[model samples]
Target chain A: MPQPVIAAVGSSPVGRTDFPGRDLFSLALEEAFEGLPDPAELADAVYVGNQSEQYEHQIMHGTLLAEWAGLRNVPAERVEGCAAAGALALRHAAKDVRNGEHEGVLACGVEKMTAGGTGGATDALSAAFDRAIEQRSGVTAPSQYALLAQRYLHETDATEEDLAEIAVKNHRNAAKNPRAQFSDEIDTDTVLESPPVAPPLKLYDCAPVGDGAAVALVTTAAVADELGVPWVTVAGTGTAANNIAVAERNMTEIEGAAVAAESAYEEAGLEPEDVDVAEVHDAFTVSEALLSEAAGFAPTGYGYQSYLPPESREAGWTDVSLSPSGGLKARGHPIGATGILQAIEAYEQLTGVAGDRAVPGAETALLLNEGGVADAVTVAHVLTAGTEVAR
Target chain B: MSGEDRLDVDSPLTLPGFFSALADGDLLAGVCADCGEVLLPPRPACYGCGSRNVDVEPQPKTGEIYSYTAVHTPPPALEDDAPYTIAVVELDSGGRLTGRVDANYDAVGIGDPVELGTRALTDEERSLALEHELEWPLHVFEPV
Candidate 1:
């Protein structure tokens, strides 16, 4: 059976501004056809990833998006799971190609968060949480993550400085990314001096709210060969979910990431050590550290050590070059589009299109996308260079 | 009449029941009769045993803090309570619940002992939640 490969990818610049009076459907349509050679030729199916219908007071996005994108009369549906909506859509698209259900599929993720102000957006996002319990206390993403950060720091040797280091590194990397929301260089002092949104987590520690869409054209390896286009094979995919309420699960660890990554590594017949480049969810500074440890790149209580000095790295910490595309921290998390954005980075890095920040000679790249606090849902994928996969 | 008399079992397996029980000064845990898996903020079904036969069990009011955060920027509902503390309380029943902690942000720490307490919701909030069948009783944990 031929493997599924992402043949083309397109993404709108991630930022807070609305896309020139267009809504999510138009954004999805524009990005969907941007990378394709012929905008009129549509895929066999369309999968739209959308997080909140409450944000736009609109539903049936998949049907609407496909119609607007000229993919009429095909299998189209919306896939959602909070922030991991994009990754889940791609996962479903890969399944379609693998099952011989479709020769090609268009997977797009879009969210128009700016339609609702910050409070309204926060309320919509909180709907993904345990509404009866967690949200009742008015807890939002930053607050839950803040609790996780506090617990992680208490249980480990990590410090607030370690958290700040992640923000600093991500911002520095974002400076090289033309599509990032915040490309300006920031130091530890900048992060430390930032206003505290939640204690132990300053404003800089959180991913900025923004609106954008990302689309990937996934087809079989045979189709890519026919088109003679650059591609990356989907070697492995895994997803896992935990308790929605942060308190119901272990805050010191992201078990979902570990579980998902293990499954993906097993499916790919590769270990964490074999990954040449990686993009893990960094919605918050604490998340990068927790995910690093959970994904097997770093050891327990040492996830933060990867961002620390060399002395820390020497102690059982073989760090992987993380988030070359600036991650959600610097790239801006537009909810539904976040996961697909990570996949885009994997495609770019594997195809040698990632400028300045590209990992040299990268062959295998891992993309990790997560939803909710402490990883209520996590999706992991291993993408190999098309050349290696063709064999 | 006592608060207990007003409490009805009509929705014991639902969130409103959880709040109703809290208002009556009891912490309820939905114990799966098939698997004995306990769920806090009670649910209608057992995720483990795939059974709807859940037994409503009352948990002790005391628990330990598993994790906590001090919110400096709160949602609109909690705007006035900015800089307030919330914790993931690990109940004696082994179930976890996130509730507000009535303590200074600097004073509370992980693993600290806490007891469940209820706060009456504002009239507007209570009426809205009641009309929508939402839980209005605020369950908070205070340092023991």
Candidate 2:
């Protein structure tokens, strides 16, 4: 079977801004479709990810975004698993193309979190937890992650400086990304001194709440070949779920991410050593440390040491560059927009369009996305240049 | 309760009203009738067997801290009560619950055995409003 290829990608400039009650999903859909090479073109199917209907106060957002994007006649479906919504949408689009159900598909992710204010938004996101056991007990997102960070610190030799290094590196990378929410170059001291949202996890250590959207145009290799457009083939896709309660799993490890990454690597017929660039979810500083180990980029409980010194970017150990797109920590996590944005970053790096932040001579890229305190779900995918799927 | 005491009441409730009835002196969770899986926080369906046939029954409140964290800055509503410890207590019945740690900052650690204690009522309006009650009751966990 022919693999699905990403043909073109688009996104709204991610940052704090005013939309004046404009439906966020609608704005993102319009932004994605406008100024494309072919405006009137329609997709065979569409997939979207949304978390809280009560927060957005809009139900059936899949149809809303589809209609707003002029894809009113296509089949559209919505998938939700907290932050993984966007990645799950892409997985659906990939499945449709892989199954020959659609010649081409559109996967879009958008979230309007600023609508309800920060406290309300936090409450809504917290609903992803076990309502009866966790959230009902008042364990918010930061607190849940803080527990993981605490355990990680206790088990490993990693320190607050190690996590600050990740924030520094990603922030430097975001400085070159025009759409990132925090593009300023920050040092370790700044991150260390930032107000503590959760102990050992400072304000700078967490991804900000922002409103934005991202979209990707995917098609079968045959369709891309006929269109004469550049593309990246989806070589592998994997997903896994853990216990909804964070306390149920090992706080020092992200077992689900490890499972997902191994599956993706196997499906792609590639090893961790073969990846040239990666964009792992860094929803929080500790998340990057845990995910890097789980994804096999570093030894278990030692990923905090993987932070390549800024000077080392020119000569980093293990040539595979990571998070050249600033990642969630610096790139502004607009929730639903995150997964698609990761794909966009991967596409840019693979195509050498990432400007100064581009990983030199990049060809293969991996993306890891997780949702809800590392408890709900995780998805990973490997992408290779051209029409040839990795094998 | 004094004004300060009311302010201290902004913590989260350890269990739902139904389960609160259990912690109030009874212990209860929905047990899967089909697979016999015990569900905490009491769900209507059995996650183990995907069966809706379940029975709410009393269970042991004894558990251990699977993991924990000492929160220095509480949520905005609980700001007055900054610097508290919260932990995930793994029940002997194979369930997990999160609540305030009964240990001081230097005393708590992961994997420590814990048992359920009485809930502390808070007066914070938002916290009270969330429980839809006049007071917010926070579950206390002690080292077993």
Candidate 3:
């Protein structure tokens, strides 16, 4: 058995970038390979996470990205689970390293969501839902989430104002992150009054549709040591799939996410309390609240208090910070690239290099990325700070 | 769809078959013989018990709103139909499914009684459907 670690990470500027998908991947690759050999020199395999071909009317992302990275023949493929594609790629690469199948694998994600504009993104994303009912019902992403938000509010003590605060809090965190898309603090009123994309979900409630790319190097311990860069160990990985239709599942609990996170926690031989920081999918404001509870960091219904400082939360809450990278809410979600973005944040946070928003003494981090309307699919990974960094 | 009916187009376990039934005005649900989980738009296996022993049964059209919302922004094909209400209705047969509610945002709430109705796809929706889906009707919920 081998220990897999993330030796390097890089991401393209998130938001409506003027770059295409492959170009975004190239920029990310350049940043990640700086002061090091080209990716072709070390990557034994490559996995690119991309959401749809409709955006650019292009597919075969594996061949395109691998060629762009100057890698010729090594095994390459694209992984798709919508927004969770990035983590799915990382999980595959990490497993390849851990199994001694590959010494170094490139885990990458890219999405040029702005290629077709908001309406284009909307129609493309609608393909993720069940075609028979959900898609035919004219449900946009926000409306699907709004259904959950509506149910969440009705079942919990939380209100629309509480959900609005989640957006505000993430925006405040994003203000400290250079990689974030919306780098300005916002008031709850801004979130409350923003044009309603769906009732119970205003414009601020949803993650922006953006274009971006991210790349991570998953390698064996020796490779990381040789690279002389601070690294983080990939301790555990877990994935779960739920019903495609949101109506079929427990909307309030996000049970699939809970199961997936628990599986990862079990593999790491750790509990929820052991996590110092987490980058859960805040694709929507309600998602942040739901994922907090799913990760076991907060009591049921008390999860909406994530906007408050940990100490100010309910008695059952742990002192864990959520979405310090500002999260999808403010950091901008490039769909496929989002999962890898989570890994990048964890890598930085645990290695003691996360700028202003760093959680002090953070040693362990959790990354949860999801696809589909709710938890149609979810990937959870646990990362621990590695030792003997020559940096 | 456990035995000989697995590939049968007439079986309620398949998508085309399910919609074909809906086109004829009868909603079908798959009840897991083991866990008794009701699967709407009936499928082959039960997610609850992972049982392939599913029994297709006619689902009641009437249900209460388990959850609801209005889509202020919709896909381009339905641009003219913005602000339409939608909901996850828990049917009388224990199966739940989402569909458009014929009402305004403020007109609906959780637990509102509604009944399912079937109709031909509008010209806009039909334009978005595939050759096969052109024949499959659309389903919506009306206040009961």
Candidate 4:
């Protein structure tokens, strides 16, 4: 089987933006195809990851994005798993390449979350939950995650301050990232004192609703060699779905994510200890902690120490650095576009183009993107250093 | 809830049927015959062991708070209902579900006993519901 790799990647500036989804996708494509041929010249198919049709009141994202990229008559479609849609698109492209079905595929994602404002985003996102109970109970995204945070804090040695520190650390990391939404570093007090969107979860603890788009060209070694562009191997991919209802699943364990990550690790022939950096979905502060444990990077109940350095974290914790792109917390969570954004961050880190926030000598990385509340569905990808053809 | 059952709104395995039962003041759960996992608002398949041999059983109305939070910011439809307390309650029968709480955020704590109650959908909830969902009763938890 051919090894799939991400040859090129780009993302629009994250956070509340003036562009529509398609326009944001253009900006991303511009950066991704910067010194290369047009997408139509190389891409044999296109996949777009999109969360909802309610935000921009538009559908047919695959057709629209493909047309915008100047490609036509390609196998194009929109993949949806709420927030995990981007990685779903990437995963589809990777499979197409690995199976020798397509030599070059464009995997892209976009979300104009700011178009309809916060209320619109909330109503749209609620559709990700089980409508029978959780949605009927008026659970917003924050409240759903707060249900987990409340339990996590109660059951663990971690305090609310510890969760706040996760936000702070991400913001500090974002300060060094040009594409981040909130680049200014914040103190723990900022997170602790922010207005409560949900109890035990202040407003700052929640990832801001934003607009973004990202595009990645997934192809085999031949395509990367032909393009002569810096690229990284897409070593493995895994995805899993748990019960959509938060109450029906293991609220704090995020077991679905664990299963997905393990599948990726197995395929990549690696263990968690081998990963140098990761972009775990920190959609909420509690999520980073929960996913840390779930992904095998942190010991049970000690994931909250993610804000600390590797040496400072509890025993059994791996040396893997989490969310060098500042994660969804500071990098911005633009719904569908987030998974592609994560892949872009990993691409930059492994290629040594991550600038100030780069994890030095980073060779392998994990990208975990989730949809719904705490892993209703999850997509994990393992990336190892691949060819970086001379420019 | 039999594996051979053909589902309809009246079937206990379906949400409409489950809500209809809740409207009649009887909480029901699907007890997995294989793993003994209790699925709240009974379904045909068991998530614990992937068993389809689920038995529809009437569950106790009382349970304790497994976790709780207050929605200080709510969806636009329920903006007036901001700061409403909600919880994930683990019942004595081993089934867990979420519902609104009839108390303040500080008034409840984990492990606090609460009794499940049913109320006709309010205008706000009705506004958010579809034509088929209009008749589904909303579950609430009251301090016991």
Compose the digit string of candidate 1's lDDT tens values, residues A174-237: 8988878887988999999999888789999999888888888888877777777789998899
lDDT of 4 by residue, A1-391 (tens): 8899999998898988889999999999999999999898889899999999999899999999999999988899999999999999999999999999998999999999998888999999999988889999999999999999999999999999999999999999988999999989999898999999998999889999999999999988787888888889999899999999898898879899999999999999999999999999999999999999999999999999999999999999999899988899999999999999999999999888898898988999999999999889999999998964221
After the best TM-score superposition of candidate 2, give how far the Cα of residue A365 lies from its true spot, in angstroms. Answer: 1.3
Query: What TM-score would every model get versus the actual structure?
Result: 0.92, 0.85, 0.98, 0.98
Error of 4 at B102 (Å): 0.5
lDDT of 3 by residue, A1-391 (tens): 8999999999999999888999999888888899988888778799988999989999899888889989898899999998889999999999999999999999999999999999999999999999889998888889999999999999999999999999998999999988899988999889888998988899999999999999999997788778787789999999999999999999999998999999999988899999999999999999999999999999999899998987789999999999999999999899999999999999888887787888988888999999998799999999999964222
Best by lDDT: 4
Per-residue alpha-carbon lDDT of candidate 2 for residues A235-353, written as tens digits (9 for 90 to 100): 89999998787765767889899899899899999988788888888988888888878887776777776577433432223556778889998888888778999998988777667
Candidate 3 CA-lDDT value: 0.91
Distance from true position, residue A149, model 2, in Å? 0.7
Clashing pairs in 2: B9-B122, B9-B123, B22-B26
Candidate ordering by DockQ (highest first): 4, 3, 1, 2
Candidate 4 CAPRI classification by DockQ: high
Q: Where does the lowest 10-residue lDDT sum fall in candidate 2 chain A?
A: A309-318
Of the pair 3 and 4, which is ahead by DockQ?
4
Report the CAPRI category for model 3. Answer: high
Candidate 3: the clashing residue pairs are none
Scoring each candidate complex against the real one, what DockQ results?
0.61, 0.29, 0.88, 0.90
State in Å the error of residue A258, model 4: 0.5
